[model samples]
Target chain A: MSKPETPPAPSCSQLFWVFTRIALTSFGGGVSGWLLREFVQNRKWMTQEEFLNGLSISQALPGVNVKNMAVWIGYRLLGWRGAIVGFVGIIVPPAIIIVLLGTIFSSLSRYALTHVALTGAAAAAVGLSLSMGITAARAVPRKAVPIAIMAGTFIAVALLHWPLFWVVLAAGLVSVAYAYARAS
Target chain B: MSEIPHTSLLLSLLAVFAPLSLVTIGGGQSAIADINRQVVDVQWLSQAQFVDAFAISRMAPGPGSLLVTLIGWQVAGFWGAVVATLAIFGPTTFLIYAVAHMWSRNGGARWKRALETGLRPVAAGMILASTYVLLQAIDGGWFARAVALASTATLLLTKVNPLLLIGAGVVIFVGLHAISLA
Candidate 1:
């Protein structure tokens, strides 16, 4: 297959600054969608097709999707330098915010407002997590073996109270064997 | 600002980050189950404390997993939080960079596609498991259970902002408290 010629790379500094801006603003949900809108749709740094491809690759690889996506976007915009700047840019804001909050939070634990707010937020965390789970579940390919694995893992961890390590290890081994067997 | 011991802070940071970085194959929530083990079961933090940190993380702007910083702080202090947050994300960030670089170069290929196919279901399963574990940890009472169930329903049925739902839960809880309803 003929390799497509790479486009002119953006400067590392440009990539760094762009990602820094995005990281600063990407609070709460919708960060990924926002990145898609800005980088792919509006800026045309990468085509929609390329963005989707990159998203899948990022999700498959370890790490947060937003951070991974940032790295990929930076690399696409530049190269190795782009990757470093993008990673650092995405990570730094959250790190700083959490540290600051941590300091205040320890002191404010006795405050009524903080206590009530945290309790409520905990309830909502469950909802957010369930929503995430539902969304992820929809993405599972309609296959018997995979579905079975999903159900089994859920039951094992949720109902059986099996240690997570054992459950994950078993599922991983089974999935790998199944994939290899099918391939052969 | 009290000086946090660097060695204890560094050790705790590594203890939290090493397992979290390696095992968070799916993403933020996927790390929760392991985090529960390390933080709660290991007595690094109590279950309620974990809930508090998680709540704060959810309410705050940024990645959900960024709550790890708060957990780090609880284990050590300000510097500990910073170190743990950095350590947790550092290797994973580099790994993502390397993988993204190779992936862009290769473009769409069979192996990549196969990996995606395998990982998607696994990630889904991990998310479900994490949700279950969280629900168990937050086992309060009928009121709490009702709130959780209602919140889950609202999330599934409506497009309301999560922060708003969180606010509603707080209002209801406070109302109950004020009225001497426990």
Candidate 2:
């Protein structure tokens, strides 16, 4: 199969800088939305179809979805060097900032106001998470089998407090197997 | 607290997080519970500290999984933070590369469709579950919960910037507290 060559491919540094910008500026979640707008819309380095495919696979695979996506997008555009840049760019800069912020917040943790402010910040953050959850919930097919699988997964992890590994394994296997069988 | 050797802490942080990487199934967030359990069970940090770390990561720019880096820093120091970042993100790097390689090579293959189609609902469920866990652990009582709901509504309804909403939350909470005092 001939690859649809993307003109004006990004170099490792370009990939790093682009991903770094996305990582730093993307806050309160929706990193994927940011990625789409940057790479597909503004840059045109990758098409929308290609980007969405990478996102789906990224979400399906293990590890951080956004991190996985960076690698997938990088690999699609620039091969080996691009992949390395994606991994480093996404993980390193953010890790540094988080550690620094952790330091600052630790000092502030002593104050009642810090706790209060952080509480408000956190409350708002939880809203982002909840909204995301609502979006995810709405995405599921209304079919009974899929709905049941979704509910079962929620119960095992959220309510029963089963270990994530077992729950993912059992649920993922059953769901994937069902999908494969249905497709066949 | 027993003084764990530097090497021992690094190795254990690597051990705990590396394996969790594979089972991260949907995304980094899905592993939060096991992370919570293992870190606490291993006596690396207290529950309150972990909750604080979660909040800091959520507020910080970048992926929320940076909580691991903060955890590592709290547990040991700079090197610990580096090691933890590598541990969590490093392990899955190759797996994704290989999958991406094959995915682009194969294009719309059976397993690809199966993996994509099959995992969608599972991913959604895990995300929802993580949100549930976070809600259960949050502080500030009903006010926080209400703040969360209003934030959700605003996100769903308006195109308002999330950073602004977060700032608004801070103001609302502080304002309400002042009114109570008066």
Candidate 3:
């Protein structure tokens, strides 16, 4: 059941700081999980159902899911201004850090140990991607057609290395059509 | 020496990433393979440089797509970073924003539900596919694979922070390396 009273909308500055924190603190992905916790569980700016709907839309759309999500949450809370704040907050701060980190690491690149450490870190980081993937896969509907589409997509992109645009377009259209037909 | 044509270099960065921007479905991770080809195979950066940048992207905070920003910086200094960042993250901003706007309107329209439900599997698959590609590309051999797998299992079963896991990875690898030398 939903809360009886909605929480007051977050200020654009509040929204910006939240996204900036998520972008800055999230080391190994799962930014979406961070978003869910921040907005739904903590702030209660939006209900769980509302958050999930926006999440699905974020995942389905092109661009970074978290960035799309920041924009979505921003738009929902504070219209166009909120969206821009979300975008800049999520991107700008971290962009500077990455460039700084890159410069520092490139200088340290001569050491074999530097690479070994990064390699280990990178490997662990893959866990973020893999776990996120497994979570997403689990969210897919449990039907033969949808399952097959999911499998076909995995094979095309991972195994065969097909372009993602076409794969998504083809699979998305078919899946959407199937859902549409079954809906009516 | 001002050998590198500033305008053309910036334009080239834009050209490379702008179109890729629109096609980055299931998040920016999905674009890595093409990016590797364009940046490495096409000779913008050598394989060593590409690998370094890739590792930096993975290790860095924020979006993994910031890899493009790093590549641009390596290729063309400050301006390259700006252009590449815009190219990758710019075009799709409008599309998602518009959809979010449309989504705000109350609707139980059949097509809306269908669109949401239909895209789920595709997005799931793409995320998995990108993960697989990343696993293959990573270095450190079997050790890396094991760390990744353990980390994945830990993430799924527990609510432990991922930064801790990454730190453990660094400590473990360095420890193991020291022991090997001794």
**Clashing pairs counted in every model:** 0, 0, 0
On TM-score, the stronger of 1 and 3 is 3
Better of 2 and 3 by TM-score: 2
Docking category of candidate 1:
medium
Please give, for every candidate in the order listed, the TM-score of chain B alone compared with the true chain B: 0.89, 0.86, 0.83
- Per-candidate TM-score against the hidden true structure: 0.87, 0.92, 0.88
Q: Compared with the true structure, what per-residue lDDT tens digits does model 3 show for residues A44-71?
A: 8988888998887887777888888988
| Candidate 3 wrong stretches, greater than 4 Å | A1-10, A40-44, B1-5, B106-108
Between the candidate structures 1 and 2, which one is better when assessed by TM-score? 2
- Return the interface RMSD of the candidates, in order shown, one decimal each: 2.4, 1.5, 1.9
Candidate with more favorable, higher lDDT: 1 or 2: 2
> Worst 10-residue stretch by lDDT in candidate 2 chain A?
A1-10
lDDT of each: 0.73, 0.83, 0.84
What is the DockQ (computed on Cα atoms) for candidate 2? 0.69
What is the descending DockQ order? 2, 3, 1
Task: Flag clash pairs in model 1.
Answer: none
* Tens-digit lDDT track of model 3 for B44-82: 887656756876787789988999999988888888888
Q: Report lDDT (Cα) of residue A20, candidate 1.
A: 70
DockQ of 1: 0.53
